[model samples]
Target: MPPPPPTHADPPVLVIRPDSARTLGLAGDLWAFRDLLWSLADRDLRLRYRQTALGVAWVLLQPVLGALIFTFVFGVVAGLPSDGVPYFLFTFASLAGWALFAGILTRASGSLVQNSPLIAKVWFPRAVLPASTLPAALIDFLIALLLLGGMMAWAEVAPGIAILTVPLWVLALAMLALGLGLIGSALMVSYRDVQHILPVGVQLLLYASPVAYSASNVPERFLALYYLNPLAPLLEGLRASLLGTPMPPTNTIVWGATVALGTFVLGAAVFRRLERRFADVI
Candidate 1:
């Protein structure tokens, strides 16, 4: 009588289980997206060079122009001592590291907003966007390094075994840029004000850093507090490694590495946490 006893068959049961979200394995995710990362990097490279008249020449031009200006301002006008090294070579060497940091930070900070459509449409690890910028930055840094090499040769300042440590210093710079850039990327997504403020902040940071002069120029009384700025040791270490200047103390290197690593980890954590909301918000 009641639906013919349901035809003596059992009704379909919907088995609902708790939706256990899989935790992201950072290493695994990065590995999985390696190809995508390379593609994105290639795309960025092409876009950067597509319509530009100078193409890759822009890379060398930036540091060269920066060196010339700095030479005029700091070397000729201010008469800042380069610790006996030629002022042009000294400032250019420092610019090698500074440019890399600045370029990567600038690109990475704007990566999210620039790729808004991709962020909204695709479902990939957002970390790849910011990380992709490093390869191009590295390429530019290498070009600047070649110029630095020529300057050193002209100056007759041959490098020593300390040059072997150059890669480690570069790694430090990459970490610092990526870390700060990631934080900027996440913050820029929510607060558009960051888009306006970041450039000014980076400019202030450049003057605060010792790019235009030597770290030794900082008064000894403020040395302790000055080194607290992580870039101080990084720029100094790069110069020492490449040009035979005294290396930053071991403690400074350790502190710089600690700060860089901490910043990167914190940035990554924040990026991952905010990523889910990126599509909806952007």
Candidate 2:
């Protein structure tokens, strides 16, 4: 007798569709894959210090060392004002926030390309990649914050009631970072130039913001335009809250919040528009 006819069953089908044609339940999908988000975040945390002798100390060292350098160069040599707080504290406070924002932006911009193999083989919310970078940045931020607390205690300088608003300012910075990261990551799938441009942009932003000096130092004529950098007011507000310096005006904080929200929405829209082509191009 001849061999029996081979059994055949239809293979499972995953009908991939363009983002425009598909209604993506982004929130739901992200919620469902919450485990993956943390997993990727954990992976990032591990990989960050995997083989380093200093381990997590690098996080503390960076802002601390930078603060010292800036204190000497800008504060001592240049006689820059520090908003009434010690220059070291002033620079450290701003550096902590800057590190968080820069870490998220840098890690997220490269996330998609770094995980190109996984992306090509799997199907999950691509947003998760950029989102995952945030946890690591937050962890670094918290570590840096602890060091700042110690420094403040040693200096006998206590945070005021405004310190309670620290988390809110952190949230605002995260929003801006994640938004820009999304835009950069999406664009990176097509343009490698973004990778080169981002570091330069970040460096420029470092000088542009009130990191090494006081926002108050900006000339009266240019102060308004300086605060236009969104990160400016947020950083100033955060430093004020931490170091008990003067708070930014209510209007400025409101403006910063609005700009952060707008940037986040714009980033999501840009990412969605380009996400469909990511797998094909990346």
Query: Number of the top candidate by lDDT?
Result: 2
TM-score of each: 0.90, 0.91
Over the stretch 8-118, how does candidate 2's per-residue lDDT look in tens digits? 221255465543333435555567678899999999888888899998778778888888999999999999988778889889999999988898889989999999998
Model 1 residue runs over 4 Å out of place are 1-24
Q: Which stretches of candidate 2 lie over 4 Å from their true place?
A: 1-24
Clashing pairs in 2: none
Worst 10 residues of 1 by lDDT: 7-16
Candidate 1 lDDT tens digits, 66-126 = 9999999999999998867888888999998998899889899999999999999987778
TM-score of model 2 relative to the true fold?
0.91
lDDT of predicted model 1: 0.85
